[model samples]
Target: MRTSLQFIFLLVYASVAACCQGQEVTISPDVVYGHKSGLAMTCDVFTPEQDANGAAVLFMVSGGWFSNWSPPEQTQHMFKPLTDKGFTVFAVRHGSSPKFSIAEAVDDVRRSVRFIRGNADRFEVDPDRIGVFGMSAGGHLSLMLGTASDEGNAESKDPVEHISDRVNAVVAYVAPTDLRVMAKDAPDRLPAYDRFPALEIDAKSATADSPIIFVTADDAPTLLLAGAKDDLVPISYSRNIEAAFEKAGVTSELIEFENAGHGFGGEDAKKATEAMVNWFVTHLDK
Candidate 1:
């Protein structure tokens, strides 16, 4: 039997492929954003053919901390909802786990943002209006960008490093907020940690990687969508982050699909996608 997470992934993929047919968008595939250990890190840029919005959104192409690549043309349908609304999208791939740790993945994504922001003019996007969206491990990465961003290193030699990584808004689905719960010796440690070596960490390291630890008043406005029936990442993760956002006076909302699992399908999928598009429109379209 497939796990809830796996099932949801397939369902969401099939639903998106089925509904997002014939979207007119220009795709620039494998644009190098940065380099890691002499390897080029890349993102596929999707620009709407009409009504091109200056704002940009980065989609973290990660699942279970494993960043995989597919032909941009094959996956372009997945971004139709955002493109239909005239939002430019960048599908960002981070360094995969088993070879890279969660901490390294975070660093890779942060660098990707810096590169995109520094080259915003080339991409025809507003540097200050960037947003991010992801699901599962990707969602966790999105939250990391939202809460732990810096104002850029002015003295850095690389021009890209001089641009801030902070995003204007965030939308995460079923993200793990407090990674400390996955500490190796924790009583409630994730049961499948062995399968995702990225979660193999001590309590101290987990705390360092947890998005909840970095939340502050100035963090990006965030929208979290979660399935109440999610078995992989409990709904409490989103609930806790929502509470933290509220306490910090940040604009945030959490929408729960009571009947869905780790991923949404059918009406729930449509609702979540709409909610995501609207959140970016309200926050990034200023």
Candidate 2:
């Protein structure tokens, strides 16, 4: 058993180190996806071989909406399943909040997706076969992208900005779909939120931008995963989103992991990862 586990580990490690097997892996780290106030917004791109499946996954690495000047490398291992399965991944890091408001972070993520889609040929991915996945605050951004995609002005000089930001699919792990509802769900958190500048807004303002308000039949297929015990965001957020999706007649699902919290662990995480891969495969091909 130990040997089998070791072998699996080695296989994944080799793939992560050298890119997945169809063609040579081309890793372009810190590729600037956008420019914000003289600052460059970059994403780590992992491209597969030419004979690849031609699908792409945009993975967001955000927590607490706090912008990080440096994009983290921790995402590579977590996304190997998608890469190995022939999906290119763009590990997108948004302008963190507090230092940079969540609104800016939302813009950065949308711009990154446009950048990826704009350069789909260069990135060896299909422009229309894109998916976005994120956890926590990252999940919030992911949801916003799905609910709020738009095509840029075709007359714009910037080619990247001129492209559409719509994705084929979206997967949000433990995301807060409605902050207004979340605030009401847990009034005790008000004190903590009071310390923060941007999050201290009234419920109406928060609800105005929540993903639940944006549900439409035209929205992309989405999968919302939540742990039953997640006190931070709560499963109710996902449940409410799931209900909205159904009301809108959009393809959507909610998966609640038992004995899990804000993040999944051990087998739960593995299953969630597998579900993400399956979702992309199921939707991207169609």
Best by lDDT: 1
**Candidate 1 residue-wise lDDT at 260:** 84
Candidate 2 C-alpha lDDT tens digits along 1-286: 2122112222333344344334344677899988877888888887665546899999776766654333334435546677767788887877765667666778788888888888888887889999998777778888998887888869989787788888889999888788675443346554545544547556666776588888899998999989999766778889989999999999998999989877766667767777888999999873
Could you give me the TM-score of model 1 versus the true structure?
Answer: 0.95
Give candidates' CA RMSD values in order.
Answer: 2.1, 6.3
Model 1 lDDT tens row, 90-122? 999888877898999999999999999988899
TM-score for candidate 2, please give it: 0.85
Off by over 4 Å in 1: 1-23
Query: Cα lDDT of all candidates, in order?
Result: 0.87, 0.75
Output the lDDT of residue 43, model 1: 96
In model 2, residue pairs whose N, Cα or C atoms come closer than 3 Å (at least 3 residues apart or on different chains), thus clashing, are: 23-49, 65-97, 66-96, 67-96, 67-97
- True-vs-predicted CA distance for residue 143, candidate 1, Å: 0.4
